[model samples]
Target: MSELIQTYWPMIVAALVLGVAVAWFVFSTSRKTRVTGTSRDVLDEGAAPAERNKALIDSAPAATPMQPAGGAAATPDATGDDLTRIKGLGPKLAATLRDMGVTGFAQIAAWDDAEIDRIDARLGRFQGRIRRDDWVGQAKLLAQGEDAGFAQRYGKLS
Candidate 1:
């Protein structure tokens, strides 16, 4: 084994490097931006007049039922709130969710663990985000109009 390793060390190193490259590509392309500690915590929930972290709409087309953007599609049908308001969810992911028929907080809040797993599977690269960011917990408060509660835990969404 030692003699073989010495003879083929370059090959082994190259294989390891290739594997690392693939992993990096897979992870960087699929995963959403990481959440910061400050961004995750709601600093102010009581300040109704103050609107922080307002929804940033992309330069996408507005259509009924769904507004598709050029790349990062923004906005959903009349019933849907800005899905990007949730932490770890960016414009691209929001568009993907919209394509999957996930429109609003109500829809997300209603997802059971089983449903989350099912949905997560279809997320392609954005898998496991639902549980990781605790979207359901945030959605539950948002769905119920509990801004204070949401702000208290998951931060404010304008």
Candidate 2:
């Protein structure tokens, strides 16, 4: 065992150095951005308003729902279809939409130009995709359960 260790000592040292380098790279890159709050502070559901507000402002921005003229927040329907069924919406985009309180094809189908603009602004990198993809038109068909029509127009909903 001593002879084998001596034989491969240089290689073993190289491997240890390589492993340390890779570990350092991974850990350095994987460090989460240093926000103003701790994970516990952010995760506390019943935190006081001051802490909650601090956490909210320090966290990454997410989609914010556009309220109607009545000032009541629009919520997604409980029986809404899986939004990922829409051609352009992958799981990530669907989750983002859900986070924004968008559920149900009918809600999307009913969006006017102004509402679409407002919501598009909140979509970050996905802005203008709604109009580009004709989501409203596709949504109208989907809401009506017109799979055949939707498929004909937008291809398969994969």
Candidate 3:
């Protein structure tokens, strides 16, 4: 029994040491790689590299005017005012309104609070801001073709 114990003791010790070494290595590696930045860090430091890269890509001049895959001109209505010119209307919301046959501010101006709420729901977190921003008043001014009142009313569009 003593002989057996002596033989296994060294093995047991080695195994324990190996486990501790492995655990330490894993823990240290994870700590080193973990993101340490807080939300304030991001806000204070400006946009991250990935976001800057994306903005650069989006703003890069096109090599050639993009044509439709099937060779169509891809011309949207040239006359109607772009609803996306409004303060809170993003590309997605503009596309949504366009899909709903809402090409201009007139369509939006016609929408009641309930309808606006429904539209705002599609925009996720922007709903409250959009509602409070007096989108209807801005839309009404745009629909009426009055420019002078807009700046005083909506501040800036973009």
* lDDT tens digits, residue span 1-158, model 3: 99898989989899999999999999988877566765554445675656876788889674442222222212335565677778777788777666544566766667676666766675666667567767777888877777778877777556
For model 1 the TM-score comes to 0.49
| Model 1: per-residue Cα lDDT over 1-158, one tens digit each | 99999999999999999999999999988887865665433446754432434433433545543222222323336778888888888999888888776788877877777678877887898898999999888877877788888888876665
RMSD of each: 22.2, 13.0, 13.9
Whose lDDT is higher: candidate 1's or candidate 3's? 1
Tens digits of per-residue lDDT for model 2, 1-158: 99999999999999999999999999998986766754565347985657767898899877465454333333446765788877777788887777766777877887887778877887888887898888889888988889999999999867
Provide the clash count, candidate 1: 0
What TM-score, computed on C-alpha atoms, does each candidate reach? Answer: 0.49, 0.54, 0.47
All candidates in order of TM-score, best leading:
2, 1, 3
Pairs of colliding residues, candidate 3: none
Best-fitting candidate, scored by lDDT: 2
